[model samples]
Target: MKLINTEEAVGHVLCHDLTQIIKDVKKVTVFKKGHIVKEEDIPVLLSIGKDHLYIWEKQEGMLHENEAAEILYGICKGKYIRPSDVREGKIELIAKEDGLLKIDVEKLHMINSLGEMMIATRHSNFPVKKGDVLAGTRIIPLVIEKKKMDEAVKLAENKALIEIMPFKKKKAGIVTTGNEVFYGRIKDAFGPVIRKKLEEYDVEILGQKILNDDPEAISQAIRNFISEGAELIICTGGMSVDPDDTTPTAIGNVGARIVSYGAPVLPGAMFLLAYCNDEIPILGLPGCVMYAKRTIFDLVLPRIMADDKITQEDLASLGHGGLCLSCNICTFPNCGFGK
Candidate 1:
């Protein structure tokens, strides 16, 4: 930073904020840091009694905050994600379409640990809607070494640190198991909840089959759905390990690879995820989904809808923020649950 005559400050960046005070009126910042001095602002500077102002001196191998922020944004910009206009040395990444957000947590950490820069973002593996601010990148100082920005670019390795996988169009068949629903012992309360959740994505309901707690019948229904071109199959009820629960057995009997039969989450610990023919997904949901505001289903649905395969390690990581507080007014996706 250097001091120069206010008249000679034109085309230079302000080193700090300049406040203008008026008695019995208002005290406001007339000019903010990083603001480029304009030719017409000379009169205002004279009126404000700022004959000499501090300004950042452009030098070799140094970058202004706005320039550094662009590098940070380049590290994060990816498919279905766009950058907000740089403002005050900050640029935010906004989602251009509704989809699942994936982040390279390790890459993001390395850039942040470099000091003098930052990238803040929403939780990874969660659903985000169009216009949601996925991440924000900025430079901490008014000016930074060009080498620092170059290091961040290298950390990206020519790939964006964040991305959005658009949800794929899928036709799903519903398998409602349990003697209670099949035999008319109780009203099928799961259908409404299941339909509402499924419709949130690009999934079309081929149809729903209400079956008894018989593994054979359940497996047959699943096969029938797969034969009818269902890309996804959801089996509600009969997921517990009880003698009467048979959905897990039915899914396994269908020659499907079970990614996981349970998660480290409450209200949906018995949730099951499987893939048939090594492509189609088959989900076995526990009973809590019918009443609970949010469950493991909400956490994993985005990944399935986007066709992003879920591995055992992916499910295991959910344990850290898996347990929901079960608040009365549940604000899922916006809460700590499954974050």
Candidate 2:
């Protein structure tokens, strides 16, 4: 990685991802206060102003400004973020400059959903200078006063910085394991319910399986899915504390590490998460998740589709005001439940 000055940073125009690389980007550098490090292939070391920053090495991948900010958030937690995880947020095209495009998030309504309202912004002309504030976001608590949340939203809009959303093309795999569901005593209502939930995110159903209560068999199916390149896995039924409820055990038997066996939130208290690896995520969902108006699964599915790694602390933070009342108008689009 190499560090370059303002002139070097703006020499080459950035691609659709809004980033370029410096020839010799360094790991770290210290710039004088109010220094203008032009935007180039190098990433920003410190963004002190709308136009001043320190540049670092440029990485490959298409990413929006807010998405990059989210990766930086993972870095703060000592987590690794792949370039593939970085994606475009809300944006729209206005005109073409030379070979570059002039885009604006607010004007284009480029956001994927309201949850991304916190990271949207109108990036200025292409070939932005070093330390230029291409886009900015602030991660506040999930539960804040509605009035306060409204204020923040207004603030971001006034500054032309809104939450950007990633292109959410999600493919789902379902694992149905239960003696009752497997034996067909009762119709498998869970699959349709999960499918409807997946529809909220427009996720496609990649595959589905119905298995017995045997933990070993269930585990093998999950492993098979990993081999099939399933990015998100959801196992329904058999998620209770009873001996017959072996969904959690089945997930563990497959050697996938569970992020949280139980969450602090209601309805989905028995929700289970297992990282088949950092790339493939498996979820053992409870029966409550299938029927509840807004369970923990409802709260989490969006994050997963957005390619976020749910952590223990992140789950624990949902305890306050997690339950959802079936609203008459279903104004969830304006509400801040999952944001």
Candidate 3:
């Protein structure tokens, strides 16, 4: 690219976008890339502080900013992920469907550290809707060395660094257990809360089972749901250490392998996660889930819906940002309850 003074750029082509900023009013691209500079545009370019402009020039071993952005997008784009139009040397990766967003943080960091380029994305392992911006790739300069962009792409190996895992399993069953709610002593509040939360996802509510604090009965209910083609089973209550709390025991008795009996998160310390035949997930949510605006349940439900298996190590890693502040105006999932 060649640089020329704005007054002498009448017949030249702009290699990059020239932005105009009117604070509190507007910030727009007055002169776009590839725009043929006309005599009438000189005063406008000067007003926007563009005393000099870069003109596009074909080079043997260099890439334009827009071209470099496509390579960066290729490094991060995966299935169910699509790219936005290249604008001002930037391209955004948008979700093709509502799903779980998985980011290779290590590879992303290494690419960003290469200098002159960057890929900014949302927190990994979180839920994202269709049309959500998963990430954006931008080149710092109007032009960059082809070798530098090649180094960025090579760091991703053969696989894309960013991915969107669409929700696979959808059939869900809820089991509410507690003597007080089972009998006429108290109303069943847990079932409603669990149901409302499940409504956020695209899943079929197989049914809700209200049972007493009997481990055998709870286990049988779980088995029944699985036999009825339940993809996910939720067991609420009976998660405490008290003698009457048998939710955890009932889940284990169902022949399901436990993933993590507890997590390092607040408002959900007694949370239990187990899998039956390594496919069907049975979650034993603690008392906090019945009332807390955001808990460990909110953190992991997206992974379960997307069929992204959560390991014990996944639960153990939530210690860093697990505490919920319980703000007056709750903006969960957006806030860091279990980030």
Candidate 4:
């Protein structure tokens, strides 16, 4: 460590005390290019008790150690932007004297509302530094009034549907139980219908189990499937208050915590969710899920498969545009059902 003044020192150094005063210190060098940043590296940086740090010219514009750490965490878990390809499009580019870039796309598919963006080079082989201009994107246009776009350049922000991709590849577990389908009676149409819905999301079934109207056995099946490593568990059959309807009861019996019992949604009002210890999610879908064009499942499934934990507020937000009437052509991305 090189100490230039009484205030602070640079290079890697550890201190057990915090009363130390460090002033006018420009930068610290804890890491360099080619070093992968992890969440564990945060406290080490913060131990210096400094809010910001600078890197060499070659290391500029790289996500801050903490921010890069978070992005890497998501990427390692397969919950991230698809790195297979970079999708780009031309928009009207407007650069301000302050060096902020405004981007406009046909539509933004976002999990959280756009607040800010981390711009970096899309190339996997090329190196990016702290001040290096990656792709410039700002959220100001999306949140501000119409005048905002007028003052900014129109540029498309090439975005990857991180949540949708995993959903498309996810192997699912389906549990269906109902006296109507268990006995030699009406066809077991729900399974095929639900399968079709999963097809739209490109979800594949890893396993399917059928049970009588027994909550205990149905719950056990859910546990069994989860133990077998089902990322998504979908339970169908009984989602209503009918005496025989037991799917909801079964899901709760399996020691899973419910997100909501009944939604303010039509068609699929009896939707239920439970998070296992590992955060693997289980859903008790209402019968309307099997037939309705737009149900609570349609609203919640995408977010859930994206690994987003739905909250009461998130569900409440959907009430503004909860109903989805079947149409000749579904304009989903444009529709605000789950936006």
Candidate 5:
């Protein structure tokens, strides 16, 4: 950094914040750090100080903070994500539409591992709306080493470290299992619960069927829904380990590849995930989902709607934040249930 006359400061970057104060009226920053002084800005600088200004001197192997922030933004940017204007060497990535947020945790760790730069993001695989700040990036200093920024860029090459997958418009089919519901011995509560959750996304219930605890009938119903253009199939009830529970067997009978039959989550441990023909997802929800305000289904449903393939590892990792507090008000997604 070097001191120069306000007139000569033009074209140079401000090294510190310039404050303008007025008695009880206002106290505001005239020009912030990293702002490139323009000819038009010289007068403002003179009005604030009237003499010399501290400005950053361009040097080899070094970059201004604003430039470093732009580099960081470019590295992590992906489809359906927009970046905010740089301010004080920081830039925020914003969602362009309502969708599910996906973060490459390994790549994010790799980038942050390189010293002097940082990127902080919201939790991965969670729902986000338009204008929400998904992530923020900045350098640790007023100026950073060019080589360090280059190394960070290289780590993020060929793929975005963060992305938002918009929810797809889908036609969903519902299957309510259990002889009690089919035989009218008890009221069916699962269908309404599933439908209420589906309403939060871009999904429409194409049709619904009530079936007894017959695997053959359940299997045939699943196939029929797929044939009738249902993009998502949800089979509620009979997901437990009881002798009569047969949702998992029914899903397998229909030739769907079961990703997982159970998860390390309370209130929804018996949740089953299967993909029909490697395309549509068929979920077998446990009875706990009918009563619990939040469950593993709430955690994984957004990812499914976004068309994200949930792996066994992904489900396994959820155990870290899988247990719901079951708060009276139930502030899910915002709570620690699925972080």
Candidate 6:
């Protein structure tokens, strides 16, 4: 690129965007790339403190900032994501639809490790809305070495480093187990709470059953739902170690593979997770979920809807950000309840 004083730059084509920023007011591009500078434009350029300008001059084995940013965008673009037009030496990746965001962190780190380039993305394996900015890529300088960008492309290896998995609508079955609720001594509140949460994801409740504290009865109800084409099963109440609590044992008796019977999260520590036939998932929720605004269930439900299997290690990792502050105005998911 050729650098010339603004006084001598009239009639020269701009090699990059000229940005003007006003504190707390606005930031705008005064001269676009390839813009032919006119005598009248010199005052505007000088107002923005640009005494010198870079005019496009191609050099072998070097890349301009916009060119480098396009290469960076190619490395991270994947299914269900769209790239925005390059602007100000940067490109943004936006979600094409509302879905779950997934990032290959290892590859992402490798790409960022290469000097003169960067990729910043939202937390992976979380829900994202349509039009949300999932990631952004840019060249750190006005120009970069072609070799450096080539290294980033080699790390990406022509594969997508980021993707969004669309959530699938699934039929759900709920089993509410508690003697007091079954006998009508107290109203059954678990079913309604489960229904409300499921509704957020457009899940259809196939059926619900309120059973006494009988492990056999709970097990039978689970099998019945599966036979009725229920893709997801939720068993609430009776998950604790009390004498009457038998939801966990009942889930096992139904031949479901229990991924975890407990979690490290507060307000939902007694949570249980199991999969039947390695296809259908069964959750044993404790009583706390009925009252708590957010719990471990909020963390796992999205993955389940996306058909992403949750492993034992996945549940174990929740301990890091499991505790909820239970603020007076709970802003869960936005707050750090299950980050």
The CA-based lDDT of model 5 is what?
A: 0.90
Per-residue lDDT of model 1, residues 1-339, tens digit only: 688999998899896667788999997778887789999999998898999998977789998888889889888989999989876688999999999999999999999999999999998998899999999998998789999889889988999899999999999999999898888989998889989998898888999999999999999999999999999999999988899998999999999999998999987999999999989989999999999988988988899999999998888989998999999887887888886
Per-residue CA lDDT of candidate 6, range 1-339, in tens?
988999899788898998999999999988898899999999999999999889988999999999999998889999989999888789999999888888999999988887788999988778898999999999988889999999888988889999998999999999999999999999998888898998779698988999999999999999999999999999999999999998999999999999998999997899999999998999999889999888888888999999999999988888988898889998766777776
**Best model number under lDDT:** 3
Native RMSD of candidate 3 (Å): 1.3
Q: Which tens-of-lDDT digit does each residue in 1-339 have in candidate 2?
A: 233443455543332122333469733223322233345423443242223323333444433343434532322111111122222322221111111112344433433243423443333222222222334333332122334334433433443222223425766789999888788888888888888888756567878899989999898888887777677889998988999888899898877888889887766788888788666789888888766677778677756765666798878867765556666666652454433
Candidate that beats the other on lDDT, 2 or 6, i.e. the better one: 6
Candidate 5 lDDT, 222-265, residue by residue in tens = 99999899999999999999999988999999999999988999
**What lDDT tens digits, residue by residue, belong to model 3 across residues 32-134?**
8899999999999898888988898989999999999999999999999889988899999999998899999999999999999999999999999999999
Question: How displaced is residue 56 in candidate 6, in Å?
Answer: 2.0
Model 4, position 103, has a per-residue lDDT of 20
1-339: candidate 4 lDDT, tens digit per residue: 112322232433321112233578544345433333355655665676644433222223332223332332232211222222111111111111111111222222231133333233222111122233323232321113333232222222333211122233577899989886778577776788778777755566887888899999998998888878788898888888999898887888888878778777766667787787748788888877666666787667656654657776766656666666666677764455543
Candidate no. 1 TM-score: 0.90
Stretch of 10 with least lDDT, candidate 4: 86-95
Top TM-score model: 3
Model 1 stretches with alpha carbons more than 4 Å out: 4-52
Candidate with better TM-score, 1 vs 2: 1
Native-to-model Cα distance after best TM-score fit, residue 263 in candidate 1, in Å: 0.4
Off by over 4 Å in 6: none
Residue pairs of candidate 5 with colliding backbone atoms: none
Model 2 lDDT, residue 131, Cα: 28
Model 5 Cα displacement at 191 (Å)?
Answer: 1.2
